[model samples]
Target: MTGRPRLADVAARAGVSMKTVSNVINDFQHVSADTRARVQAAIDEIGYRPNLSARNLALGRAGLIALVVPQLDMPYFAALAGQVLQAAAKRDWVVLIQQTGGDLTVERDALAGRFPQRIDGLILSSTAVGSAELRKRTDRTPLVMLGDRNYQGAAQHVAIDNVAAAAAAVTHLAELGRRRIAMIGSSPGDRRHPRLVGYRLAMKAAGLPIDDRLIKPVRNNLGEEGEQQMTALLAEHAQDPPDAVFCVTDWVALGVVRALRTRGFRVPEDVAVVGFDDIPYGRAATPTLSTISPDRSAIARLAVDSLQAQFEAAAAGTAYEVGEQQAAFRLVVRESSGG
Candidate 1:
């Protein structure tokens, strides 16, 4: 019954000490669940709110984290960002998003801590930045890599196993009796893309011929690129089109579907198609996409936790070894793949 409820009010209402209330507020794992629930209930009943700014100030942090992505428009990145935001909110942390447009200079600037405001930590999903550039980072901000890039122990990382996930997608197509399974996301002269390697490996394992003409390279992993490349593939292989196609992203798969429909080809019936990143649109499309569903929530939680660990280690003046965490993924068969 006060103007502004405080921590002591919660403690008094919960029949616990101020330290216990603080522990509950901080989400300290050592606290018992029953005590934590009592403190939380008390806080809710009393309408007690902790001063996050003051607390972060005392902790020598801004309580802010940055999520750097290549493109915010991409459904997968947007979904991942949403997951990261949810994870950060559980810790009472604010997230700042930065888009680099997959530009090397912009990505490098992000790695160098060039942001609109100071951030306590960073989670970057970069393909343009490499391990050497990552090693050149001069800032002490805790950082976690959030994609399939091989940082080579240069930083903490969280991602699904792209190679395995891609292989699984192709294997699904192969098991469906699709002999000519085409891929639509290879970059010219960039042989290290795990998905591309997986596509090739899956074709060999299935005893299917890896047709170079069917393996189209694109400038980007966008719907437009997929449409263009699919058109080209159709023209080049008009006599014998691919029986199935594996796209790098759900967006690309959508475009492939469009091209196929425009040419009077039916999905799964005439040519099966699979994509990656199970975005909502893919699930709602005319013929729902079969795709690789990476555990985005797990990746976000792992990335944020890794950053928090680094922050704690730095504050304690302890050495923190960088880590690579592989998030889980699964193949979701849908209408596009005749599921």
Candidate 2:
């Protein structure tokens, strides 16, 4: 009635033992429904919140997980983080977010468990990390890879099939009779990007000419980079501009749209556009963006579920095998692509 309500207080209020109150709080299945209901009622009446820290300590856990991404400011990552937070919350866990700025050292540090405090697990959307570094990780923290980086057997992973998703986007453009299709967001000298491969494969399959000038490369997957690249493409091929463009991200697609409007090119008329990651902004854009929509909520759920499985296995002194999970995705057509 005065200070923070304790387990004993709830037990007293419910006319039950402290052990019964603890079992109810921990969600142990042995407790009867009637007793559980009484304990919950008392908890609600007394406004007694379980001491999560103490409970987690007793269970040898932190009840907190960290999500490390290349850039939290990116809309895709921000949206994914929100999904992870919601999924973690359902399991009575808290999420901490960290950004790596696409630095390999920072990503390596995260894999090595160099955080200031102990985290029960980690979900990493890595940009520069490689399988070698992943294999070299000695940290005991349960790890779940989030994104298209292929560290397959080294850790548990959840991601959409980038190549297939990209191909689907490009194919959609091709189906719309856009032969001079272009791609943005490929990095020069970086061949590991599956999206780039997808674009090429789709172009070839569609019997469309893969003009080198139309395939633009950017140092970053940002709106500004997309705009800059589109401008360069238009300048270089002023006589023959791409009929459609597939951007690696929604932000980039939005930028391409802006650049097209500036050049007096109509969307899906003179130039159609498609982007990946169905970020909320794409829906509200002047000409709603068409994109490859990865099931981010499913990805988050899988990643968290994988980590929780590992945690449970460790607690039970059992071995947990790591594996990869493919999250579902689809090509969403919109006004930008003449949907």
Candidate 3:
């Protein structure tokens, strides 16, 4: 019975040493062109291919990069995942995607142990673990963080200035005569909790009183949670509802619009609204949501660059500074915000 072609047979057919044949098959450049062509011809005839798994084991490199997110279901994280996938593809790198669902314990577990060795490096957008624990867990592996500031680790951090970005959204609402600008967001305890501080700062800067009653905190920032929160906010404001609302995410913005419609509040006419992340659905929503547009593609580019740098530094035994790397976010005016 015919069997799989052996490397020795290919080497014999190519008139080269087994080592030379192996080198040529692995695309190691040291093989002479004449010898490489002969080996290629032999391999073509025999359909011989080197086992990648064995090669990786011998080289002691996993050849994998991970992109970890807090929640896969969230539109913002899903979009971020797409960008990371594209960036990794350009480098011919394999990506391992994991969703931690914003659980601190789960996030910590994901980072602990031999995660660095498991993958060449990781691109993480965490909502749980701060920079301190992350630094402790990642022992010299390439780690590029996407969101959740306060992680001033020695790795690269790519994120938007949530405070500043959120402030801009609130300021825009204020300029439009939105005195009672309500805010909806994830838990205030989250590090990258969008725009709460900025909302307060903008309100105070505009000589508007800061009211705790106007802040709506959701359990998990889930879309349904956003809808429920919007309903509660509207109910509280039944006597005198807010003039405008600023949701922390486009998912919440979608829900907020749903609640607005159910409550019979005409968007932009009776109650204006703005959201962040600018997810695609925001554009097609009934009134089209106005939002802060984060440059997700740019963030992906920066993250990939940083991860490459980190991978190089780790291999070269060099140290890099870990500081804040802010991404650009623009305010996109739409029908909801009176644009």
lDDT of 1 by residue, 1-339 (tens): 858998888999999999999888777899999999999999989888899997888788889999999999988999999999999998779999989898888888877888888888999998778888888889999999988777889999889999999999999999999998999988634578889888888988999988777888778778888888888889999999998999999998889988998998999899999999999999999899999999999999999998889999999999999978999999999999998
In candidate 1, where is summed lDDT lowest over 10 consecutive residues?
Answer: 185-194
| Of 1 and 3, the candidate ranking higher by lDDT | 1
lDDT of 2 at 197: 82
lDDT by residue for model 2 (23-89), tens: 9998999999999999999999999998888889877988899999999889999999999999999
User: What TM-score quantifies how close candidate 1 is to the native fold?
Assistant: 0.93
lDDT of each: 0.90, 0.91, 0.80
Candidate 2 displacement at residue 161 in angstroms: 1.8
Per-residue alpha-carbon lDDT of candidate 3 for residues 287-331, written as tens digits (9 for 90 to 100): 999999999998998898787777667667787666677889999
The candidate that achieves the highest lDDT relative to the unseen native structure? 2
Judge candidate 1 at residue 67 and give its lDDT. 95
User: Clashes in model 3: which pairs?
Assistant: 131-151
